[model samples]
Target chain A: MVTAREEILERLERARPPAAARPAAMPEPSMPIDPMATLRDRLQDAGGSLQFATRSGWTEQIQWPVEATTLRHVYSSLNAMPGRGVGLSSKTNHDLADLDVCVLAAEFVVIENAAAWQRPGCLRERAAALLATHLIVVANATEIVATMHQAYARIAPSDASFGWFLCGPSKTADIEQSLVLGAHGPRTMSLILLSD
Target chain B: MGHRERAREFVADVDRTRWHDQALWFVRSKRDQAADLVPDWEALRDQASAIKRSALTELPELWREFEEHATAAGTVVHWARDAHEHNEIVAGLLRDRSVRHVVKSKSMLTEECGLNSYLEAEGIEVIDTDLGERIVQLRGEPPSHIVMPAIHLQRAEIGELFAKEMGSAPDLDDPTELTDVARRDLRDRFLKAEAGLTGINFAIAETGGFVVVTNEGNADLGTALPGLHIASVGLEKIIPQQKDLAPFLRLLARSATGQAITTYTSHFRGPRPRSTQELHVVIVDNGRSQLLGRPAFREALGCIRCGACLNTCPVYRRSGGHSYSATIPGPIGSVLETSRDPATHAELPHACSLCGSCTDVCPVRIPLHHQLLAWRGELALSGHHPAWRRFSLNLVAWLFVRPTMYRLLGRFARGIGRRLPPTLREDLLPAWTRQRHLPTIPKSSFRELYRERQRQPKRPRPQAQPRPRHERNG
Candidate 1:
């Protein structure tokens, strides 16, 4: 008896249309005039914020809530901010559920949609980005791209086990099409553009 | 019941029908604004369409390449011949691991396979994590719209549901407060779930990776926290290369909800490096192979499931999604459903006004109206249409070939129509004239007016003014 995979593949091969040459690629769209300005505007439209700071001053510029000093649990993977790290050897990801703030580094940012490409190294790091109340991503200002096409060309899928293009904070318009931020993920997403 | 009968019930509620229509039109207007921002929107659509068509012709080789690469990346891949097989495979995996609780993002493919009920029968708790999907799941209802699953329900109704299910205030109706209630409740489910299931938006054959896009980030959280992840994909979701993702990612959110992009577009190549983590992909054919074999209707397989066709369809707006009674409900749904089971869904093709709006807004340019029209012909030929409708259509066809007979019948009908009272005239076609007024009958047919105009003298053409040329004078 034929297996399901073999049967399905056989049927597909029999029913497939005659192979044809792929179409010629179209010309690329022009890049934005000012990538930083476009990224700021688009990020604002997506309900996220963008700020510029030097590598030395970026930590001071984050708008931490007034109560954050005593109760906040900050997890930073960057070299500048050496916050307390979660136990990576934990068996499950549930340990990071109480995290208040998480700061990671993005490979590049796209100007057209204001998405930051972040590749988390492990399962716990990836879960922290979603489980925390606030997500802050820091990237070099020179790494910004004009569109998704340029962003894809810079990265390979095999380079990371998990990767994501996070545009804004988690949001939903599911209830009567009313825009609501902070739907089961980070309430706010802030991107810090480092100059140094 | 058929689409016509189900649509009548929806139309009976005049206020609700009007509200639904306006809500969808608002989204359509937003899509137009988003399209205007892109300078090469049409060229992008052409490129996406060409890429999908090219991929369809060589699906066997692409899937083979995907399997090899995915296996090397430590991902397990499965194949299902139909919905029943798909359900069995998913259930078997969960049963082997003793996974009692699973959190799933919005997966229309699972809805098509009836996976929820199938898993529930095996004593597994499957929770839908998307905000809209969770609402409908609690109410035990199918999603009315693909992108906005609960668009048909109002805030008050959702509030009442939450009060009953989640212990929220009975009178609370604000969308923000209600969403918060759900967010807190779903976060608990996410923490408890042992497995996560999602649907694939695009599967890259070159990378052996797939993308799952969402505005809510539920797919990411659901999969990130859980050690086991299973993704269900239709065979047609395959694309050739990673660079091919650019045009599709650009158009998906803009065409769906007028967003520049979804909040989270996560790519998964393999399971996490942890020893306990696993990633399983089920590639199901169902009836897609038959659809691919059909030359006239094959383009419907190119759909990216953006739901733009549903938002822009005038008929779909007035008639609620429940009227179609399919997992996907709109212009594209009508084409796909009728093709899958022609006899049962014979009336679906006639549910269109053929305004051609759906085709204009389709991200992949599926030519939806043309497919719907072709379904009509196919159904009629297969004897799926009623005998009376077939007979009447044959009579009309016989008369259309004879010019004299057609004109005489038209004149006779007009003369009789003019003599009858307005109410009596409306009674002749009650289905068509129920909510619309019939136009007043003219004294003469169009052919008669044309003949009389031919007898009158034609107006002389205005004399052309000759151009003054220096060369001619010289």
Candidate 2:
């Protein structure tokens, strides 16, 4: 006698009440740092700064310790952005359509025409890159692929350049008719394109 | 802020002109494929949700433990109940240290707090180090999309915006060239910033550490170079341990950008080598404690900001992020807004295809679609529904539930609709349909067919009874 909707409603009704009891054993932040000391240290750490190695490309080094305030400032500023970032590259020889930006997300490295975006596997990689905080487009300067049409030439029939269309974070402003930020998606962008 | 039918109208108009809806829908399909690729996607989602729920359940204790451990590790932890409190604590911490001019990575919580506005008012200049954020900052605009704030913009528009805003060339059209120009602009700010702010992706209760995922390594660089480091996190962001991190980390980047992982998933437990800037964590409640107490929407707290639903939502695709008018937009935006301020965002829940794509796409498995449906009930109970919409919904319900009334109405509609003059009842429909005509319905209702079947003889009809014996069961 139970329709699917009825079963769902019934299950929902049977759902347990929100856990009334808080965990007795709560973990606390081990040792509260002297706020002043932490800041002083942070400013000193800033003296070290970050230096990029051309060989390994964009690698992340957290440094032994990260001051909470310094990190907060970085994150806060970063949060309020969709910076001027675009990934571009030109690789004349094509085994795939469009450049793969997937590797770029973590490696900050751009790969030449490794696979066609129209291809299932290749397209997935490209899509992942577009959604990333930064993008890498690897192509020969002479071989430019910008619009969806140029993409077709590079991608195989099996590979469709769908990922390119969803290039940024997916978002909506359906609440109160105001454009609220970060409803969903990256909220920022960085693109690295190979020039030569 | 709330959803205004007017903004939605504006988006619809633009959507029709640009066909941007199809573009977003394509992203939705990509999300679906990505989800489908993992056979254990649903199970992983369940585990992630369960982990987050468990973490929230034990938040007070975990938070306490985190504070103790982080402090021991040389990090300061501060508790705040709302944006003002969180910002105040942060500002107070800075004032104590004589710190000014902070650098930052993307932190939506700070944005919600209007931290930059607050800081500017407090006579502090803040620099955003993330590339996209810097772009919007230069243009003096709020981000449009979560991932790509300026997604609504074209290269030419950006060129003009930067040119006029940043004193760059007025006609720079190449996205690459413009980006290089901004890089130089932001690099200067980064080097000079005294403090850095980064948002917490996941705050580990056990280790007293936080994770910041970034593709450009902005968080790593910004935090590394700043004199002071501040991480602002909502209370709900805490997770139990690093062991529980794998599933989320694995899912976060891939489900979000289809990557193996983000470029940087840095875990910061303490200040650098000997000392880093004052390491302070503003553990903010800012509406969260109250939200956690509300059972229906408690799961909304588990969100990791992947933005899958926004990409998948048809309505969001057409309307863009501006229409919802909240800090967060899209289907998830509707859910968050409904929970935050029902009256202001009452109309948001209606902007759904009910396709359940959002629910399916969610990495944390928030049951977004169901929550969206639940909002309508919550909104109605709260008396937030518009009178006209309520009446229409009631009228539809009445007719559908009453077969006789429905049949008669169907017949009447068919008769009148078929004979309608060239100039139709335009106002009766949404503007989307003003230019398009609806197909006329047949005079009869499906119920008529059902009645006719019942009227037929009960005795076995030879042709029907035979039913091609072999094929009958088949």
Candidate 3:
């Protein structure tokens, strides 16, 4: 008996068109003259905010709640802002549901669309980015790329089990096309650019 | 009912029809703005089209390569010949894990296969996490628009539905407050789900991975929290290389909603590292192979599901997506649905005015209006058109060949048209004049005016002036 896979493949084999040559390499769009400025504008358009600070002063620049009691459960993997760390422990994704703020390091940032490439190290860390009320990504100023083409060339699929180009906080315009920020993920996303 | 009948029903609500048309036109205008920002927009569309064309020719090789790489990366790959098999495979996976609750993001493939209802029949609880999809799912209706599923609805209608279902305040029609209600509701469902199911946007054969794009990040959150992830993909979603993603990723969001990019463009290679988690992929070939074999209609496989064609389609914008009554709506849906069942969807091809706006806005350059035109011929050949329509068309064709007969008939029709009362003339072609007024009949034919001019004397021509020597030499 032929398996489903075999049957489908056989049908495709029978119906396949003649092979055609792949087109020449896609031409790269010219890089923006000021990538950081472009990234800031694009980020703001997507309902995200961008801030700049020196490497040492970046932690102080975050707009932490005026009342410390408001942020009860903060999850930060970076050593600069200490919080409850999931680390390499076997923390289930549900354990992070009540997370207030999540701050993690981004591998790089893309300028064409203000997005940070976040490769969470553990399952809990990955879920934290979505479940938290506020999400912050820290990236160096020198690591910005101009387009998705440049971004893809920098990373490989094998680098992590899961990765994402997170632009703004999750948003929806489903209700009569009215833009609503914070649909299912963090309500606000801030990218802190460190001037190294 | 045929498209014309359904469209008539939709257009009966004049205010709603006007709103729907303007809403889509607004999105189309945004797309034009986004396209203007990119200097190389046309080049990207051409490159994306060529890459997809090349990929379709060797799908067998691409899928095999994808299966191998995915398997090697600790993801299970399954194949289904049709929608039924696809549903069964997904249900069996959930059943094996004893998963009572499953959280799903927007996967049109699943909708096409009726996966939600299939799972529900098996006593499995399924929740659509996307805000738009959940609204429609709760309302027990299919999505009217691909990008904005609940676009056909008004905020007041949603407020009422949520008031009844989610226990929100009555008459609370504000979008922000209503979205907050759904956000909190879906978040709890996301945490409790045992499995997550998503649809693939782009399946990279070389990397043995897939990418899912969403603005709300529902797919990411749903899949990240659950131990088991099952992604359903159509066979046409495969690409040959990783670099090929650049052009597609660039065009998809800009064309879909005029965004620089979606909020989340997630890439999943396999299960979570060092865990017993599972990642399963089901590749479905539901009439896609047959479509690929067709020379005239094969390029449609390149669709990235952007919905730009829908936004720009005058018929779709005015009539709304539900009028088409197909899984996917608008110009592309007409082509795909007619090819699958010509007898049933024969009216879909005639739904277009052949303005070709869809082809111009298509990110992959599918030439949608041309294919819709071709479907008309195919349907006519297959005897899908009504006998009366065929008879009338044949009569018109016969009259068109003979100039004398054509002119005589034209004169006779004009004479009758002038004598008829205005109301009677409007009622003569009720279908055409129902929503429009007939133009005033011409006083005389163009041929009569030409003959009249020939009988008159011609005016004299002006004398040529002499040119300077330097100008002449140059």
Candidate 4:
């Protein structure tokens, strides 16, 4: 009996046309520009906020509670996260919904879409970056890339099993073309660019 | 029903039809704005098209390499020949895990397989996490648009649906509030569901991984909490290298929603470590190979499902996505559906006005209008058209072959229009004249006017005067 895979493969091979050389890479901008500024502008356009701060200043900046109901702060890193709050590991996935603010370290950030890349190895729970009402990603200024091509060049396939490019707060223009943020993910996303 | 009949029913509501038209036009304008920002936009499109062409040629080899690498990376791989097998494999996976509930991100492939209905029949509950998808799921309707599934629905209708389904405030119609209610409700489902399912946007053969891009973070969130993450990938989604994602990622969101990128573009290499989570990818052919066999229509597989063509299509915008009545609807949908069952989808190829806007707006540059035109030829060749229509078309073609007869017929029609009664004129062409009046005929044909101009005498030109040396030098 011919397996489904074999049948499918045979059909594909029969249908396959002669091979052609792939096109050359798209030319990158040759001019010098600040990737951090570009990232901040892109974030603003996408309904997200960005701020530059020192390590000590970022801790003082995100100290306030955002929502009246369940404003618990959560963080994966033990570094300079603000205020006394519950850690991501302390709560189960069910209770993580009550989290208002989450502070996580970004491996790198892309300027083209203002996306901050996060890895499962760094975050205590993978859901923390997504479950919180408001998300705050901490990234170094030197780690930003001007485009997705540059971003992909920085990482390899073996880096981590789960990684994401979180561009902005969850948004949707579905209902009558009205732009609404926080559809099913964080309502607000803020990126803090820390100078190394 | 034919696309025209369905479209007539949709446009019967004048106000709603106008609203749908403007809303999609607004999205198309946004896409234009986004495309204009990239300095190398055309270059990127060419690169993406070429890359997809190469991928199609190397499909079997690259698919084997992907399966091997993905399997070696601790991810299980399965092959499904059709929708039935795809649904069975997914249902069996859920059954083996004893999963009562599964949360799904937006995966059109699963929709093609009717996976939700299949799983529900097996006593499993499936919750869609994307806000637009969840609204339609609760309303027991298929998605109207692929990117924005509930684009045909207004917030007021969604509020009523949510009030019944999730028990929100009875009179709530605000989009922000409705989105919040869905977010809270789906958050619970995400945390409680035992398994997660997503559709692959692009699967990389070199990296042994796949990517899922969504404006909402539902895909990442759902897979994060579940013990099993099942990605239903079509066989054509495989790209040879990770770097090929650059052009696709740049074009996808821009073409779909005019964004530089989706909110989340998550790459899943394997299951997470030291946990119960596992990754299982089902590579689904589901008639795609059959589509590949036809060289004339094979380029349809290069579609990335961005729905830019739908947004720019006058027919789709005026009639709405439901008119097509397929899993995908619009130019790409029209081609893909006709390729599957030409007889059933015969009306779809004839639905377009041959405007060619879809061809121009397509990021991968698929010759959509040409494909639709080709389908029309095939459909006509199959002898499936109505006798009267075919006879009328043949009569017209015969007249066109003899120019003198054609011109005489045109003059005869003009004379009848001038001499006949209004009722008789209306009866001359009932189908076209039902909605509007016929245009008044001109005195002469353009060919006659051109010949007359050529026969007239030409005026002589005056002699030119030369400039002074100093002025010319200056």
TM-score of chain B of each: 0.94, 0.88, 0.94, 0.92
Lowest lDDT block of 10, candidate 3 chain B: B427-436
Considering summed lDDT, which 10 consecutive residues are worst modelled in model 2 chain A?
A: A72-81
Per-residue lDDT tens digits for candidate 4, residues B132-184, read: 89988988999988998999997789889989989998899998888888887
Please list the residue runs of candidate 3 whose C-alpha ends up more than 4 Å from where it truly belongs after superposition.
A65-69, A85-91, B417-439, B459-474
TM-score of each: 0.95, 0.67, 0.95, 0.93
Per-residue CA lDDT of model 4 for A1-196, tens digit only, reads 9988898899899888777777777777432276666677789878888887776666665433363334556654536754235554454665666667777788888887788888756324567667777887788877877777887887786777878888778887767788889877788888888874
Model 4 misplacement above 4 A: A30-36, A61-71, A82-91, A122-124, B415-440, B459-474
Q: Stretches of candidate 1 above 4 Å error?
A: A65-71, A85-91, B416-441, B461-474
**Could you tell me the lDDT of residue B24 within candidate 2?**
56
Across A12-75, the per-residue lDDT of candidate 2 in tens digits comes to 3343235533223212112113422322232122121112222222223212123322221111
Ten contiguous residues with the weakest lDDT in model 3 chain A = A84-93
Q: Report the CAPRI category for model 3.
A: high
Per-residue error (Å), model 1, residue B460: 3.8
- Pairs in clash, predicted candidate 3: none
Please give the RMSD to the true structure for each candidate, in Å.
4.3, 16.2, 4.0, 4.4
Clashes of each: 0, 125, 0, 0
Q: What shift in Å separates residue B87 of candidate 3 from its native position after superposition? A: 0.5
TM-score of chain A of 3: 0.92
